[model samples]
Target: MPVWLIWFIAALGLAGAEALTGDLFLLMLSGGALAAVGSNLIFDNYVIDGVVFLVVSLLLLVLVRPALRKRFNSGPALPDRAKALEGKNALVLDRVARHEGQVRLDGEVWTARPYNDDDVYEPGDHVAVVHIDGATAVVAKVV
Candidate 1:
């Protein structure tokens, strides 16, 4: 019946769509529709309410949505398995050179390569895992 009531209903519909999507985009539009309801109640003009809705929606989409998405998406700070192996000592199982080698890390033998192109490790030599590249472990002299 009233313009404000229409806007309120639209806001509720947008919020319902947002629930199904789980994305904040529709929620931002729903916020704009709610603002339109207030504008309609105050000015009682369709054009003014439309303008308010557009401006509020754009503001929320550009500014508020990013912060909200980041806050909700950034979950627990769990440690990465590969990153955990960095700097840990491993025993060279085979001659380790820049091109290829093998090392025992955490009781498991892994394909290895020297971090420095010229560095080489012999069997029984201890080295530190510099980083992991796919299935290979880049290692450096432990000392």
Candidate 2:
């Protein structure tokens, strides 16, 4: 049993663990184990190989891991449900005037009112959701 052979086995085991975990942490440890295999070739000493493995693993965890995680985690920030309805298209299910109306948004009926005081939306008209005011949707006629 050579020291390099032991490190190679450890690297293979750690790589299998990485596949199970799906996190890059174990993969970084596997990289360190591979480094130890290289160190064993140069120094041919188990103690120095173990030291190199520990140092390389820690460096990857502290320095490289955060950057990788941040890059992978970057995505669109989702707005809350209430805010998400803003600017959505809706259909006027009932006559819409400044005082009262009804519209269908996302297949759900919602209380609606014209965005402008004099504006009116007839049934079958397409409208844009301006904002939600309490239980009501402020909407504007598409045309």
Candidate 3:
């Protein structure tokens, strides 16, 4: 019946929903509800309680959360030693001449092409997968 009770219930419900959804964003809203309820409880002043909670929640979501996510959500795009080979190394599995060949890297075979003429390589030659062009891998002799 009280606004404080409403805020607390809403917070608890959102937290439970976050447990089910596993999105992590809803948890921020739940945090806001908790702050609101806590402020209301401590001050018994609804206006100040609501304002403080709102400001806190917004600050947490906009400033704190993005920084935290950048640190914690490192995945394949993370430029670290573990993914070093992604932009380097390829094995020439086919007799390559000019602009067409096959290479093996990234745990799979791929159609390879060269950047220019007069570039030729043979099977078992180590090449560098310079870049990916569409469905093919562009290669250069490793030297």
Candidate 4:
């Protein structure tokens, strides 16, 4: 039938396909097709409608898609697991020396060591996790 009608149908099809992928690309093409429908209505020329479609689609893909994707994808930033434990109190489960020890942190047992090689903590003493080194917790006496 009319060129505008064909473009309108293509736009509808592209928008429907966009639901399956959820990537916004086909939705951008659908936007272009709608622009083509408008251009065809105004000029009734196939060449002008095609050009309008190309330009609008490329503009949406390059300019709008990234901002939309970023907005959709971004959320609250969470702290790293190791970093979250720093400065938290722990109970010394065994004598904590520079070389080796054990502590209860957040209800879980963790391998621990004193932050200072010269420092030592007896079992039942309170300590704070200074930092994590791999699976081991580097700690300091709480007081």
Give the Cα lDDT of each candidate.
0.96, 0.93, 0.78, 0.96
> TM-score rank, highest first?
1, 2, 4, 3
Candidate 1 accuracy as TM-score: 0.68
Question: Candidate 3: worst 10 consecutive residues by lDDT?
Answer: 78-87
Tens digits of lDDT, candidate 3, 4-111: 998889888988998997656677878888899988888888898789778877887887778767776875665643244446888888876765788888778878
Q: How close is candidate 3 to the true structure, as a TM-score?
A: 0.57
Candidate 4 clashes: the total is 0
Worst 10 residues of 1 by lDDT: 72-81
Q: For model 3, what is the alpha-carbon lDDT of residue 83?
A: 43
Model 1: per-residue Cα lDDT over 1-143, one tens digit each: 99999999999999999999998999999999999999999999999999999999999999999999999889898898899998899999999998889999999999999999999899999999999999999999987
Q: What is the TM-score of each candidate against the true structure?
A: 0.68, 0.60, 0.57, 0.58
Please give the lDDT score for candidate 3: 0.78
> Candidate 1 clashing pairs?
none
Flag clash pairs in model 4. Answer: none
Report the alpha-carbon TM-score of model 2 versus the true structure. 0.60
- How far does residue 129 in candidate 4 sit from its true spot (Å)? 3.0
Residue runs of model 3 more than 4 Å from their true location after superposition: 13-26, 43-45, 73-99, 104-108, 117-128, 132-135
Residue 21 CA error for candidate 1 (Å)? Answer: 7.3
How many pairs in model 1 have backbone atoms within 3 A of each other, for residues 3 or more apart or on separate chains, i.e. clashes?
A: 0
Candidates, ranked, lDDT? 1, 4, 2, 3
| Clash numbers, per candidate | 0, 0, 0, 0
